[model samples]
Target: MKWEDNRESTNIEDRRNSSNYGSKGRGGNMMALLPIVKILLGTKIGRIVLVIGVVAYFFGFNPLSLLDSSVTPSSTQSKVVNKDADDKSARFVSAVLAQTEDIWSEVFKKYGATYQVPKLVLFRGSTRSGCGFASAQTGPFYCPADRKIYLDLSFFDELAQRHDAPGDFAQAYVIAHEVGHHVQNIIGTLDKVQKAKQNFRSEKKSNALQVKVELQADCYSGLWAHYSMKNFNSLEEGDIEEALNAASAIGDDTLQKKAQGYVVPDAFTHGSSAQRMKWFRKGFTQANLESCDTF
Candidate 1:
């Protein structure tokens, strides 16, 4: 993964230190009361009270309730801070993102279509997304609604220490996989699958569809890898192995077995270890977009 000298993407939004939940002040305290209100409104009596309160407020019957001084709104501000250690990871991610943009732009040109680059968001703890509130626990995800990829750099440490998939290339593969989702969104694959999922009544069928989506993204990641290596000679000796190991480590079977000491094939939203590795290899060896049709 010789990416240090490569170009960095300008589409990156770094919100690593921003607090989306709220700031620790009067506004924060008021915002923090929302969850409690939601919980209380979950009950029948509380719902009735809420309805009455709303009605009274609209009729000006409860002016004091509407003019609560403690519920003042405040603007949320974000502050950007860079840590020395994270700077290296940020550069690597930016480089990988830029490479994907270049490769995919070329690939799309061959198909008589223009590629629209997606933004990449680097955040920590929690952040607001078009899809919803996101946290590091949600892992890396691509929100088609916003056409952006969100990531937490700390996941690299978890990938290395917990998943046993150390190496810069493995990290690159993760970014590529999410970018692959953006590609699927561009090519209408995600739209078709999502439409089909709407008619699926069974959880098993839904999960199966999700598995196909995930595997295809994996193959697309490999497609990027294939061209990246061919175009820029970016791969080192163990890079491919690092990516394969990462695919295997995060497979549905491997993760489920580790979490619950059992495996449920029907619950697999992603494929098995063998399936993930095979699809990735298929795209890598074939070195073309046609080889990435997991559906």
Candidate 2:
């Protein structure tokens, strides 16, 4: 938690000021046209047009196509950046990223390999990623295609308020977990997992494999914490507890139960609450690569 005095990473790409808000998600364009549709439907002439459009729709003529063509998704939205307010949060992220770089670099040295550091991207509402166009709704993730970590600092606030997992360490754990994915990417674990997932015909079986991958990342996060504490004595009181609470809070079972009032293990891509906490503890206590083999 003593991160302010720590070194900040220079590999950060701050795109917070230039917000890209366009989303090509399903029903996104339709949702954008809602206000226009509501106004049109409120008019008497619009009712006639709507009835004619419905008849035309049944007759193989589409009127909605014209409306769809006219609506352009906003690609660039200017967002005022509060430099003073975001400076501390950005520094904290940079500090955590620096720690991961140091920890992983040292860890990779033991294996006789050079650690290729990944870039961390900071964006506001939305931005383009190598994987795809992403928004804050996507949360923090590592895109193997670009070898970069995309993050919106606002997710930390959501983590605290919505998930009941707060604290600096919890935020660090998130960055560490994404970095763990990058570790998997460089070490060929991600490629192997992707190939294996492709071989599975059943969605459930594939999801099970994904759970293994996520649990391993959780373990690697704990591994990061282990080295971070040993090397820099960074952990303070309740730090580990904050991370565990975070891991538990974001567990597939916990989120599913919270959202739907029930849990479906078959649909779980990430492990259960107990499984996540256990793997994290395993890596922390064992502090070895062998102990993190969730596969």
Question: Which candidate comes out best when scored by lDDT?
Answer: 2
For model 2, residues 189-213, the per-residue Cα lDDT tens digits are 9999999988899999999999999
lDDT of 1 at 70: 36
Cα lDDT tens digits for candidate 1, 18-86: 545422343655565677569759999878877886787576453222435432121222222457778
Predicted candidate 2, C-alpha RMSD: 8.3
The runs of at least 3 residues in candidate 2 whose Cα sits more than 4 Å from the true structure, single-residue gaps closed, are 21-83
Q: For model 1, what is the alpha-carbon lDDT of residue 181?
A: 98
Name the regions of candidate 1 deviating beyond 4 angstroms: 22-82
Tell me the lDDT of model 1 at 119: 97
Error of 2 at 33 (Å): 19
Candidate 1 clashing pairs? none
| Cα lDDT computed for each candidate against the true fold | 0.85, 0.87
